[model samples]
Structures are given as structure tokens and as C-alpha cells.
Target: MHLTFTTLAANQTHYFLALCLELEKQGYSTSIISFHEESNKLIADAGIKVFNVFEIYRIEKEKNLNIENEFSALLSKYQIECPNILLSHEKVTFLIKDSIQLKEKFVLYFKALEKFFNELKQTHQNNVVLFQELGGFASIVSSFYVARGMGYDNIYFEPSFFKGRMFFVKNTFESYKVQENFSLPIEPNVLAYLENARANKTIVIPKKDASHYQHPIRKIVNTHNIKRLFQKLFSKYLSNQKEEFNYIGSFVYRHIRMLTNRFLFIKYYQPIPSEKFVYYPFHVPMDVALTVRAPLFVDQYYLIDYISRNIPNGYSLAIKEHPAMIGVVEYKRIKDLLSRNDNIVFLNPDINNHEVMTRMDLLLTVNSKTGAESLMQGRKVICLGDAFYNKSKSVRFVDNIDNLYKHINTALKNNAPNIDDINVFFNSTYSQTHIGELYYCSKENIAQSSLSISQYVKANYGK
Candidate 1:
């Protein structure tokens, strides 16, 4: 068997390489595909073939080749009907913006990615397995699309209901489909993992730095952010390239938002009302669960407005800001939301999420990780968007905005915690996924957890 690992960033560095090392020990040939040269060096030292995506793209583009023609050919290779997955990109609509020039520019970039995928496919044609962690980026999503379109067995880790646990699926669609019939008792491993999270206060702690979700620190240390700052500065001032791929704009925007917060002195975050209220935890605008699975509710402000206006008369609606989205969402937008909505109150992002969920009357979200966590905590959840747990037939899911009232009523009426479904879901999930920490959490799990790659590949792919 051949295992190809693709990833980006330092956070993904150790976890992915750990997986590769485990796979190698299992008698499978392995290769590493990464943007980070640092990670590539480590993998190369391990005697695995390492492909740096950026360098490969640069080298491949020098050849006498028409990218558009190659891109079209690549698309033709995938016969299955593809949905408009491009719309899932975070800033795609804004980038194109009906501008012919921008559209042309994006296509130029897209063609290059398609060519890279082509090169990648040709190199690994004999491979029976492909492991990827690139669905987060728009450009890299193309590679996953191509890989899946070619019908290679796919697997990726998604945030599970628990803090440390991650949900793995062979195919995206398969995760959403509930089993017809099964008899699997709740696993002890699942219980142990949750207890460890409780002991560590994992769910209770508000994740200050997105980069170090698992790493706990005594004081707020932002070495990761500082490193990113230096990288952006170098890309902007020292590089001096004509290409618009410079990171200055993003860094500048971030700095501006930080400055804006200091000067504004406008506090919108309110106490989680010690009264009856339903909570709607805001999701990061760029989350795949929001953009890909729940496009209708991507415009969170609008969704908040709809909820504020239409929430049942008896209860107040509480909204909490997502920690990572503090600067990304404009201060004025948040201010205007609190100012306009009489029944709506904003909860502080720093508040312990576990406590908030425990106290809240009901939880509502468009497929957020927090919402899933609420389900595990035995809170009544009303998911307005598509979720893997939507198949559980235990939680309330609203298909349309108009049905919010109905769903809310249903969820509130069936307010008792459905521990049975929670156990069943975890057991069903454990059967499909192996216990391993990737990207975040205990490094011990990565080293000790059994590799599920070969088993998944064999079950999903050919002999």
C-alpha cells in the first residue's frame, strides 16, 4: 500500500508526520506533500519522498504548457456530477465580484492548481491510498475534489462533539448516513476520552489562540502570532514581488482591527442573562461546516437578525461571539446587532462555553462544533443546517428558516437529555473511526493510537 500525506502549516507538521511514521511501520510506502520546507526536511530524513507544493508549482509552470487546456482535461477525467463546490470558498465571491479581470486572474491560479494535481496524480498513479488535510484552503480543495472525482478512497478528520476526539469518515457523504441496524455498546475508550477532557477543563476553557487549541499555557503567550507577523512582514517588504500573493494586506487588516478595538471602547458583550434564553453560538465565517454544508446561513448577521425577530415570545435569544472571529467581524456590525435587537443579548466570548451550554435553556446553531458539544453535554439542540449528527434522528434539525419556530418548539418540548442517542452516536462513530489525535490535543494519542489508514483503505478500496 502507498500512503500520500498532504498538509499545510506547523500545527499540522508533527501530527501528520507522526501518522506517516506509523504507516511506514505498518509496511506501507509513504510520501509527504507539504508547503512547509521545514516539515519536508523532517519527512525526507525519515526516508520518505517529500514534495513541496509551492516549489513544484513554480518549477512546473516554467515548462511550455497551456494551463487552461490541462485544467479542462483534468475536469473531463472526473465523470461524476459535481456540485458548485467553488461557492464554498471564504472570499471567492468577493474576489471575483463580477469583474472580468479578477475572474481571469482566479482562473489563471486555478489552472496552475489543476496542473499541480495532474502532476501529483501521475506520480502517485499506482498508489492505492491518498491521505489529505487540505480541504480548508480554496486552492487545495481542488486537489481533494480531483482525488475524489478520480474515485480514490478518501478520509479526513473533522471536529467531533468532544474537545479531544475527532470524527473520521471514509467519504463525506458516508458520515452523514446513519446505519440501518447495529448493535454496538458504548466503548470505554470514548468515556475515558471525555473524562480526560473534563479533568483538563477542555470544554470549559475559551480557546484564546486558534493555533494552540490543545496546548495549555499559564499566561497568554502569542509566539505563534508573532511568528506569523514576521512571515507577513518578510513577504511584504523583503520579497518585493509583483505578484499579489503578498501577505501584507492580511496582516495590515489584522493590525487595523486590533487598533479599532482599542479606540472604539464599545463593549457589546453582555452577561449571559441569568434568565430563560436560547443561545446561538456564532461560527467563524470561513468554517467549512458553514460555507460548504450550510451556505444559506453563511451571512451570520442576517441569520442573527432573523432569529432575534422571530424567536418565540416567551424566551430571550442570546448570541455569543466566536473567539477566532473577534477581529475578523467588524466592531460596528456587532455593535449594530446589539443596538437594534431588543430581545437579543451578546455573551462574552471569554466565558466558559461548557458553563454557558449547561445554563442555557436551549442551543441553536448552523452546524457548529459547539452545537455538537452541546449534544454531548445532553443539551437540547436545534441545528438549522446540515450536520453529521442530523442523521441521529434524536436531535431537532430545521431544514428551512420558516421552520425555526416549529423546530424550536419541538426541541424545547423534548427538552430531556437524550443520553441514549448520544451513546449510540459515539459507539457508531467509534466503530468507523480510530482513536487518534491529529492537528491538536494530546501528542500521546498520536504516538500510541493504532493506525486506521490501512484498514480504511482495504475496506473502501480494492485488493
Candidate 2:
């Protein structure tokens, strides 16, 4: 099978190239359709056919015609009339869609992609598969559009870990073997592979760098005045509303008491007091809600107030700031609500989520990977909203703050979490066992979904 990879981001490098290299080693002809000059250079340097679309458009004005015409030129450059299966990055496709206009520029790129897909359909016909690396609404939408264009029944979205530098070498090899033996028309087979593939994976390298998040050090030096100024400026341009700075100032004042506990310290590495409290780690990117005419921050504050009124007199709450959004806003509203009752504490952090999870009594969060990690550690995880990991029977989710006191009473009264249950859950979600051989078959999998020579011609020439 032969494969073509088309992508635009000059700075971003994807696993498609590596996947192509592996396929080539297994005796398949692999080529690249690079959108950027730099990427074309890299592909050529690697001794592969490099279809430099950007350069072609630069040098030839005719190439600037409808995207379909430019696409035909690109296909001709690569000597591919049609391909068996055409694979491109979903994110890049969406970025291009959003970046271009539908009249001329959009039509041009669409034609290029359509030509590529049509060629695949003509050459390979029923063998085309569109793959999504990051499975989300956007990825699914992108796949739907591409599948419609190519008339492909087989569409697949693989796990994020199985791509890039982090993919397990053994797993890829095993998948290759399986694909070689597997029959054609692989939609159902691919779906089955995805279900089992999750548990069959190994931790080859630590997950991609945790450095992608906001630094924790910013919390210490960012005083109330600075944060207030930021709040004013943001409210003017981004969110034209005033933040209650005084409330936050008072809230930070009370957090100074956490210093009493040597082991319970927050960002400064202090200790936490052995007090019974509910920990809520706020998740962000909710600011996007404003675009849809939603008042997200206000709703969050109201929820915090409800929790403050309902929690029992002696017990308290702990709120953790999202690592991504440290200085922009504070959990002061939640803090002030709890302060009226003197039962809520906000934890500052100098470290990462792994360390924070270890120090907590119970984790209360929304849909986050932390929910999964907490369950893996056999900790009490309470999810407040719909997150991917919330469907577990092992984790508790509080939908309403009105029931917060009752639930806490019930949990403390019983606290019946089974170690065996935790072990079973962990094994189901993360444990890597038995299916180590599957990784070796990765090449076969690639080949099975790969496009053949004849398929490319039909997709492009509208045969």
C-alpha cells in the first residue's frame, strides 16, 4: 500500500511521517504532500517524493486557480492519478477551513483536498479510510466532511498516545502484523481494534511534557493589585464586567493559615492541615462560553455560594486553581462564600497535579484527566459535572450543591471504598497486560488502511 500525507503547519511535526517511514521499511511506497516549503525540504531530505504545493502555487500563477485544479497539478507532480486510501490530519483540515474564505480561497483549498480524496476513491475505491488523531466534535465533523467527499465507509479516530514520539514501538509493530492478515473493508475491524487497543497499551515513555500548562510560580508573586488591574483590562475588552477584588483579597488573607500545617503546604511547599474538607479543582476554557452569550463565571460563583450554605458547620471546602489560568482570575467568590461560614480553604500550588492529588482528602472536579488519575491512585474522586471519566461507579459525582451536606455526611458515615474495586477499575482503564503482541502488528494495520496505486488515479481523474 502507498500513502500520502498532507499538512500545513510549518512549525508542527506529526507522526504521519514516522508512520510512512515504518510502512516504507515494510516494503510499501510512501510519499508526502507537504503544504509548507520547510516540510517539503524535510521530506526530500528524508529521500521521499515531496509534493511542494506552496512552492508550486508561488511559481505558477495558473496553480492559483480553483483549488481542484491546483490539486490536480499536485497529484500530477507526484505521478499519482488516484490513491487507494488518502490520509490527512483532521486538525489541519479544520484550521484551513476556518482560515480560508468560501468564495475563492476556500474553494481553492477545498478543490485540492477534494481532488486528493477523489483520486483515492478512484484508485482504491472501497479501501479508503479517514483517520482522526484527536477525537472530538471538530475531528468528527472533519471526518464526516472528508468521508462524504471520498465516498468512504471506513473512518477511524485513534488514541492520542498512539501518535507522535510517544507511540510504543512494540505496539506499532504488532498492529502492523494484524493489519497484514486482516481482510479488506476494515471499518468494523478498526472499531474493534480501538476498543481493545486502550487496555492493551504500555507506558513506553512518560506522557508528553507536563510543561504545556501555566507555571505555578506566577501565583506567588501576582498580588491583588496586579490581578485587579488584569481583571479591569480583561473585563473591558474580553469581559466587560467588574470583579469583586476585595472579596479575593480577604480570601487570600485566610489561606495564610495553611502555613500551620507543615505537610499540607500549597505552592510554597507547606503542609496541609488534617481537616475534613471538600476539594474542588476548577477547570477553564469556559471563557469561550461568553461568545455564546453565557455568564459562566457568575454561575460558578452561585454554585460556590450554594455549597457554602449547605455544608455542615464543622467541615470545610478546598478550592484548587486551574494550572492553565492562574493570574487572570481567583476563586475569591467561592472563597468568600465559604468564609461567611468559615468552612472553605483555597489551596495554592507550587507543584503539579500529581503532587496535589497525593495531598488531597478527596478530589472534586469537572471532566478532566485528573479524574482518571485520582481513580488510579484509589483516592476518593467526586466529579461535579460531566467529564469523560465520570461514568464510573467507583467515583462520586455531586450534581447539586443543595445535597452537598447530605452526601458528605453519608460518605463520612460509610466511606465504604473497596481496595479490590479500585484495583479492578485501575486494571480496566490503565493496566498494560497480555496484549503486548498487538504492538508488533502496527505495520500490518497501516498497510491494511493504506491506499494502493490504482485507487489514487480514480479519486483524482473523476473516473
Candidate 3:
């Protein structure tokens, strides 16, 4: 089988290369569709066929191609039902505010990406598998739709609820839907992990996973960031490097906003109150979990306001910023939410999430892993979006926001998930998940993960 991996960042490129090396050893052919020149060189040095997306777009642009017509043709050829999916990417919306401009850029991206995939399909025609890290970037979203339309079996991988494991699925930003006939014996490690998490009343995040929540100042000052900053500057000004679509936004403005929020918002955060409340964990801004999976809940401030106004009287709506979004989120928006609603209270982001969940009357979320964690704790939860665990009898999924009050009350009245049911749900999850970490590039991890991934592919898709 031919595996084509799509990578945007340097770290992802390195990780994919390592996986490619391991997969190649198992007699599987691997290639990469790289967004940047540096990654193209690295993959080429590894003696792998590397398709440079930027270079392809540069070549295509020199011909002065009509993007509107090309985009329309591609859409018709693909029989794309929801063309709006292309515009739903967070980066696309974040970078291009003007509606017309966003559509035009997205069309240009579609034209470029369509050409890239066509070139790929020519070289590797049969038994081709596409792999991408689940993200809310325009390229990732576009490629996913384009691949599906072209009859390629595309797989997306993301960090699973269990640390050191990853969930692979065909659906965008959703859990693997296990086939009806599929079943695997529940592993003891799965039970042990859940037991430990419950016993300690804490979730043990892998160091690699926790690294995303590093302080913004520290991240900015890091040697790697400094080097990357210089490289990007050089590429933009001195080098003949084509401007990548992902880098169209101003990082300096983002950094300034993040830093400003970090310093100014401490005063707004209040202690977790003793009063009865419903907890709403803030999602990281621009996260695919929200941008793609829970698009309606993208405006969290609006959701918070709606929930605060609609929930049963006397119960305050408690909220805490996601640690990964500490300074990244807009503090002014959060401040405005607090000012507008008397019952909406802002909690310190540092407080133990499980601790807060334990005290809450009910947890409210939009496809957060915390919803799953709460279910593990047998706590009441009201999910407003497409969470993997929404199928669990424990969760109250709000299908219509108009009936938010009814859902909230219904969840409040419902019993916590039975331990047996929770076990059953996890057993099924364990059966579908592979033992590996996403974006964890340690040698030991890569070797073990590659073995697991390769074995899975062989068992499921090998001819």
C-alpha cells in the first residue's frame, strides 16, 4: 500500500518522516505532501517522493489560472455537496476577515491542492492511503474533502482520551465508528488507566501533550521559536520562497494580543465559588474541536451568556479558560461576558479541572475531552456538540439550542453514568484505539507507534 502523508509544520514533517522510515522497513511505500520548502528538502533527503505544495501553487499561479472557474470545475468533478466546508476552517476565517476575500483565497487553495492531489494520483494510482494530523487549517480540510471525492481512503489521527494513545478515524474530528462486527477483548491497561485517573482524581497528561500549554512568553523566547522567527523573516524578505497561505496572518499582532491579555486578565479571574454552579470549560481558540467539530459553539462568550440566562435560577454559570489558551484567547470578550451576566463567574484557570467538575451540579461542554473525563468520574454532563462520548447514556446532548433549558434540566435530573456502562464504553473505545501518542516524536514512541499503526493497516486494509 502507498501511504501519502500531509504535513504543514516542521515538527509534523519530522514525525511523519520517522513513521515513513518505520513503515518503509515493513515494505510499505511512503511519500509526503509538504507545505514548506524545508520539509520538502528533509523528505527528499530521506529518499522519499516529496510534493511541495508551495512550489505547486507558485507554478500554477505563474500561468495566471482563473481560480474561480478552476474551483467550480473541481467542485463539480468532486461532486462536493457542502462547498461551505472549505470556508469553515479556523485559519481561513481568522486570517481573512472579508467574506469575498476569504472565498477567493479558499478557491485559490482548492485549485492548488486539487493540482497537487492530481499529480499524486498519477504516480500512485492504486491502494493509496492519505494520512493527516486532524487540524482546522484550510489545507487539511480541503485535502480531506478532495481525497474523499477522489476515492482515496483518508485517515486522520488525533490524541485519544487515554494518554499515550491515539484515535484514528476516517471522519473529520470524530471518534472512530467501530464496525458492527468488530470486537476486541478489553485490555487490562485500559481499565488500569481509568482506575488510576479516578483514584487520584486527576488526569495525567503526557509531557508532550502538556507542552502545548507552556507559557506564551517562554514559548516566544525559546531558541526554536527564535530560529523559526528568523527563518520566516528571511523567507518573507530575502529568500525567493513563495508565501505560504497559513502564514498570511500577523504573528506580531497575535503575540502582542496574547501578552497583553496575559498581563491584564489576572484581575478578572475569580476563585471557584462555594455556591452551586454549572461548569463550562473554555475551549482553546481556533482549535478544530470547536472550529470544525462544534462550529455553532465557536462564539463561546455567546454560549456562556445563553447558558447563564437559560439555566435554572440560583445556579451560577462557572467558566474557566482552557490552560492551552491562557493568553491566546481574547480577554476582552471574556470580560464583556462577565460584565453582562451577574451569574456568570470566571474561575482561575489553574484550578484542578476534575476538582471543579466534582463540585459542579452539571458540566457543560462543546465536545471537550473533559466531557469524557466527567463521564469517567460518573458526573452529570450536558454536551452541546459532537463529542465522541455523546452516545454514552450518561450524556445529555443538546440537539437544539432553543431547548437549552430543557436539556440542562433533563441532565440535572438524570443519574450519573453507571460504572458498568462507563467500563463498557471504554472497552469499545480501547478496541478501536491504537496504543500511541500523536505528535510525540521520541524514538521509542515512534518505533512502537509505527508498529501499532502498521499492524492496524495490515489487519484492516492490507490486500
Candidate 4:
């Protein structure tokens, strides 16, 4: 089997590489087709064949004509034959554009891909189209249409989170001992443990994101044609505290039941603590202010300076660039912006957001997933604008520089949130099964096959 992984950026390259090495170890050949130079270098440095799209030679030519001709040439080179498995990385923005325009780009890209595969079928009929974590709404819906139109039978979709019984099964068995009982979901031992934990409030970690809101209801309200009508309806209905609490209360009930009743507990839950930090996660379309549509301009550096200069002398600010934004953001520009502030501390790249937020006293974010996670972790999250979790007392939503400073000061003295409270917030909102179920896959098969890959490679290809 020949496997090829396609990507523009190398954000999830490690995950793809792990999958590829597993395949190669199983006596299969693997290669990477990446558009970025950094991606190619990383794969090649790991002893994998890297097929680069545009390189030094391609860059030598003039801009427009060069990119057009080179892109065509690159496609032609790969157009020879289809591989057994072709996995596409998540769709990334080639350039920033309006959301409406971005949707058009997505449509065109998929349509072009549809045409490519339609042609590829003539030579190599044995091809599978696999997409990694349908990154966004547009991409997911687009892939569904493309896959159906092309009639490519081998289609696989998986969730990107780590939640479910299967999750703890593989993890617990791996930690303790693998057993046949672990394979079954209705494990009496596990249920008893989880029940006990819930009763004692021992397992106070965060719940899934969707549990924080009525996502489907919100989606309908936001996406419907008559926005004004729904806005009025929402305002009227939500205005009543009883109605609103009942609405939110019912949402939490489902997750609380599922978690306490279904999933088993393990003794290995990671601990999180309270500390203070300035978190600037990388989000897209240049100005996150636009995407977030917040009432203020969220200049991360400005926020950092204000915090460092005004937040007294006792608090420490942890600054971290989004893991995915490492190459995208010019760190030099950011460094230059913060050159005057000695109080800013950059976090280690490998630090998990979950762990970091748990220990942090407060999290400062514009509109990032970390903000949502921070809210769920029961940390005092100070949002500068309309983040997903901007509604909580644990969260202080500000609209401008001066207001941000005001709220930051307020948050410092506000009530501390316990982990159980965080759980309640998350449980009362989003649907747990939507994204959580996907993360809880049975990875035992993947792991066993992966381990066998190295042995198989040595047996077939020699040491």
C-alpha cells in the first residue's frame, strides 16, 4: 500500500506522521506531498520522502504567472496515478478574505477536487478519500458533498476530541491491565467508580464544550434568514430568568447523567490549579476582531502591556502564541511590540492549554477555544470581547482597552470558581454527544497495528 498525506501547513503533521509510520511499518510505502517548505523539511528530516509543491526554483520566477504555471505543473506531477489511501489535511486559508468570499473559495476548491478525482478514476479506480477532522462547518459540509458526488466509497470521518468510554477503556487498560471486560461499555466496576466520583464531586474536571450551550438551537437562531425575528424571540424568551435557567438547566442534565452514569472513571485525571496569565491564542483572518465581531479592537500586545503596567507588581502574565500560529505570526513583530514590557513571560510550546488554564488565576483571551476551556476549568476568564464564553461572572467581557483594564482589575478581586462550578457551566450549555463521541474511539486497533509496523518494516525492508 502507498499512503500519501497532503497539507499546506504542518500543524497536525505529527499525527499524520504517526499514522504514516504505522503504515510503513506494516510493509507499506509512505510519502508526503506538502506545499510548505517547513513541512517538507520536517518530513524529509524524519527519513520520509517529501514531495514539495513550490520550492526555491519555483520562487525564482515572477509572481502570478509563476504560481499559476508551477501549481499546474505540480498537480500534473501527482496526476499520474491515485494511491491506495489519500488523506487530505484540514483546509487552510490560502489567503484571507471575507467569510462569504471564503465560502466561494471552499466551493471552488472542492469542485476542482471533484473534477480531479473524476479524472483520476480513469487510470486508478482503487482510491480512498479520507479527510481529517472536517475543520469547520464549510469544510465538513463541502467534503460531504464532494465525497457523495465523486462516489468514492471509502470515506471515513472521526472526531478530534478525547472523550468516551472507549477512550478510558484503552487508556485504563493500558495503564492497569487490558481485559475483555474493558471492551464492553457496560462495565459494572467502571460504573460504580464513576458514580462514586460524581457523588463525592471528586472528578471535577471540565465537561465537553457543546455542553455549555444549546448549539443546534443557537445555530438555527444565528443562521436563519429572519435574524431580527429570532433575535426578538430569543430576547423575549430569555428575558425570563425562570425560562432561561430551565432552558440551560435541562441542557446540563443530559451530560451530568451520561458522565455520571455511563463513562467509567480512572485514577489518572490530571490536576489543574489557579494562577494568572495573559493568553493570546492564534486565530485567523488577520483581525480576530472581525471574526469575533467584538465591539473593540483586540490588540494582544496592547492588552499585554496594559496588564503588565497596571496589574500591580504581584501578578505574572503568561503569554503564549497559538500552537498553530507559530509560523503564521511574525514573532519578531510581536517581540518588537512587547520589547518594553519585562513582565511578559512566554509559555513553553508543549504546555497543554488544559493544564496551563487550570493552574492560572485568570486567562486573558479575545475569542479562542482556550477561553471556552478556561471557563469550563472554573478559572476566572477575562474576555476582551464577545468570546463564546463571555456570559459568565467567572468571565469578564470588556469592549475596549480601558474597559479591559477595568475588568481585569475587577476579575482579580472577583470570586474564585471551583472545578465543580466549571463543570456545571459546560454541562448547562452544549450537547455532549456531538463532538465528544468522536474523540472516544477505540484506539487499541490503531495502536497494535502501529507497533507491528516497525517490526514489519525491519522484516521486509531490512534493518
For this target, which candidate reaches the highest lDDT against the unseen true structure?
3
lDDT scores for all predictions? 0.61, 0.43, 0.76, 0.43
lDDT of 4 by residue, 231-314 (tens): 444543664211111223322333343233211211212223134454554443233232224323434555556667766456
Give candidate 3's whole-model lDDT.
0.76
Could you tally the backbone clashes for each prediction? 0, 50, 0, 15
Per-residue error at 391 for model 2, in Å? Answer: 3.6
Give the Å error, residue 414, model 4: 1.1
Superposed Cα deviation of residue 171, candidate 4 (Å) = 36
User: Which candidate tops TM-score?
Assistant: 3
Q: In angstroms, what RMSD does candidate 4 have relative to the true structure?
A: 21.2
| Model 4 weakest lDDT span, ten residues long | 168-177
- Give the distance in Å from residue 246's predicted Cα in candidate 2 to where it truly belongs: 38
User: Can you tell me which runs of candidate 2 are displaced by over 4 Å?
Assistant: 1-14, 27-40, 44-115, 135-145, 148-207, 213-273, 284-312, 323-343, 351-359, 384-388, 397-412, 431-463
- The TM-score values for the models, in the order shown, are 0.80, 0.50, 0.92, 0.39
Worst 10 residues of 1 by lDDT: 212-221
Angstrom error of the Cα, residue 121, model 4: value is 27
